[model samples]
Target: MTFQPAGATTIAAKTPASETARRNQPLQSFDLLVGPLSFSQATRRGLAFYLLSDGIAVWLATTGLVAQAFVLLGLSRLLAVAFGRLAAGRRSARRGLVAARRPWLEALLYLFTLAVVAAANGTGSFAASLSGFPASQALRVSAATAIDAAVGYLTVQGDGFFRVVTRGLLSLLKGLEAILTLTPWPVLFAVIGFAAWKRGGPMLLAVVWAALGYLGLFGYWAEALQTSALVLASLCVCLVIGIPVGILLAKSPVSRAIASPVLDLMQTMPSFVYLLPAVAFFSIGKPPALIATVIFALPPLVRLTCLGIEQVPLHVREAMQAHGATPLQTLLKAELPLALPSIRTGINQTIMMCLSMVVVAALIGGGGLGYNVLFALQNVQYGEGILAGLGIVFCAVLFDRLAGSGRKGGA
Candidate 1:
């Protein structure tokens, strides 16, 4: 059963002829199809130019350059419909001349009505603009004066609302300042050693304490506190609206559908767009900044709250239902407890978003670390800007870590 291989001469003799025949076959076929191929090429070239010109025309129309084309088309269609209707009405009345002439008269009437409507709309817009301009100016001046007066009053009294509220904060800082200033390095090391024993080990404790010492050396302690306060206030406002909206959306499908588009717009629109409206309404200062931050930061909380409630297990809901639990009771007991972790994460995200926005908000006169950072940027003081930016970052990290830890522990 042994098979013999072909010799090289025999194999070469047969190969080239077949190869030449196959190559020639394609040329023969091309000769037959050339007329059709030429026709296709011409057709394709024409189509490409046609499509390209059409695309350009469409773009021009969309951008308003060819707006008159659309206007003419609309008018033509309207006239055709009006004429048809008039003809029908006249035929029914057995009046040919009136039917033929009525369409033109109707079209003129429509044109007049359109003009009237447009005039009214234009007048309304003009009046609104005029009214809003004065109010906007008044609000801006009032907001600026109020903020300046408040700051000046606090500065003069040294015992105003801010001072009273920040007393505990000042005390905490003073204690830390005393400890870092007066305590021996060895005593600090000993405290670190104690923390290491309680928490993990000496290495972890050393890293933590070193970070604290570095922050102090960089003089970021006070800036950090101020940033924290700003973020806290922003998050509080975000939650006040976000959570309720979320709950409402979760309970009502109609609400969810209605709100989803608005949320999408809010979340997708540029953060800078928010600034103009905020300035228009609230004017520049912490309040406007607060409003912007809330708008920017609140979407996640609402979205997450709706998500968390929806994700609750059906069985758990059914169990509550079987036990004759009312909707509110079921939500309070079963749903909220399970949804807390998600809500907390949303809150954490809200805080982070607020922290990031505060810097942008500074452009519109937000104070605290935001103002400091903006001042540094404007004055070309890199050191000050970097320090203030880092202060904001530290506060964000601290809040995120603390909130995350609470979420984990609570769960």
Candidate 2:
């Protein structure tokens, strides 16, 4: 053992008491406040600001100098900024501002700005004067004219092209309807069951069984089939258009830059907006309704498809290239397969959107359960409306379940 030097004192290690003392020391530095009263630095500054601003307001109003309130407000804000920087610097030099402490100087400035404005002239009155400044109507008219001219130019000039495309879409829609409506019920049921079994296994097959039985037994077989046909036709068109565009967007940043805004507009636009343009281009009927539904439902698939492809593992892609796989093979064998779940989710959302548009579409001569619901509404038959509404719900749930099955398989 070593001997200690004479006159040396030993230092003790920190105990729990010392730690508690340290914590309490910091607490002593704060000026605590409860309820309406506060003695903290921020509170004191805020109180000073409140009194000063009010004094200024009272002087300005009493002296008939209220017109200078705006200038006073600006000066007060500049002063507050200066005070904030000073306080921040002081705090940084000290123990530093703790998490619980707040910037009261900034709060004081905001409070003064609002109070000064309200006391000098009412906020609403100030806003009204701005609104009545004679420029609002001109702006509105200019915006409306621009929108109208753009719409009219496209509609008038592109009529021939739209007409040709509309005819082709109409033919395809009609053919799909005929196929679904004209097919024997047993055959259709079998096909659906087989598809369900192949994609989703026995449990999904049972669900399909129950769904088909519900429709068939309720004398809704024909109308249900027609709705299905409409949904399928729209789904087909959406996939055809959306997938290619999605691929292009995924591969090219330039394409994505151009298309993303358009997709955002399409997705956010009101469902009714889709129908108006369709009605203008094609008369109110299944063709127009189908076109409207297509517009309403197509964006999600494209967006999700692009998302899915982009989300594919970069390492996997690199591995494919390392193996000398062609771009087509890499996409088909790796990316698309992995992206199937997201794409399926997109399809699911698209189907639901199409189903939701049915009632709206029915308003324009698109027939099915929507027509029945409308009829019930007109006649005030609550039971009939409820029944038809259930029919639509059933259709939505059935398709949703089928689509959901693919997600599990994809995973």
lDDT at residue 358 of model 2 (Cα atoms)? 89
Mark the regions of model 1 whose C-alpha exceeds 4 Å error after superposition: 1-212, 406-411
Per residue, candidate 2 scores C-alpha lDDT tens digits across 170-252 of 78878988888788989988988887777777877787788888888887877887788789888999999998888889999
**Alpha-carbon TM-score of each model against the true structure:** 0.51, 0.72
- Among the numbered candidates, top TM-score falls to 2
lDDT of each: 0.63, 0.76
Tens-place lDDT per residue, model 1, 1-411, is 944343212443567875533422311112121212443333332343234333443564676543444353344335544554555566646632222222334334434533433333344666455434345778899998997787566556654644443444334434544545466656755664455434444444554455456555787655555455566667766777998899899989999999999999888988888887566545465566667877899899999999899989999999999999999999999998899888988998898888888778888876667888899999999998998787777656555554553221121
User: Considering every candidate listed, which one attains the maximal lDDT?
Assistant: 2
Model 2 lDDT at residue 125: 62
For candidate 1, the C-alpha RMSD (Å) to the true structure equals 19.6
* Residue-pair clashes per candidate: 0, 0
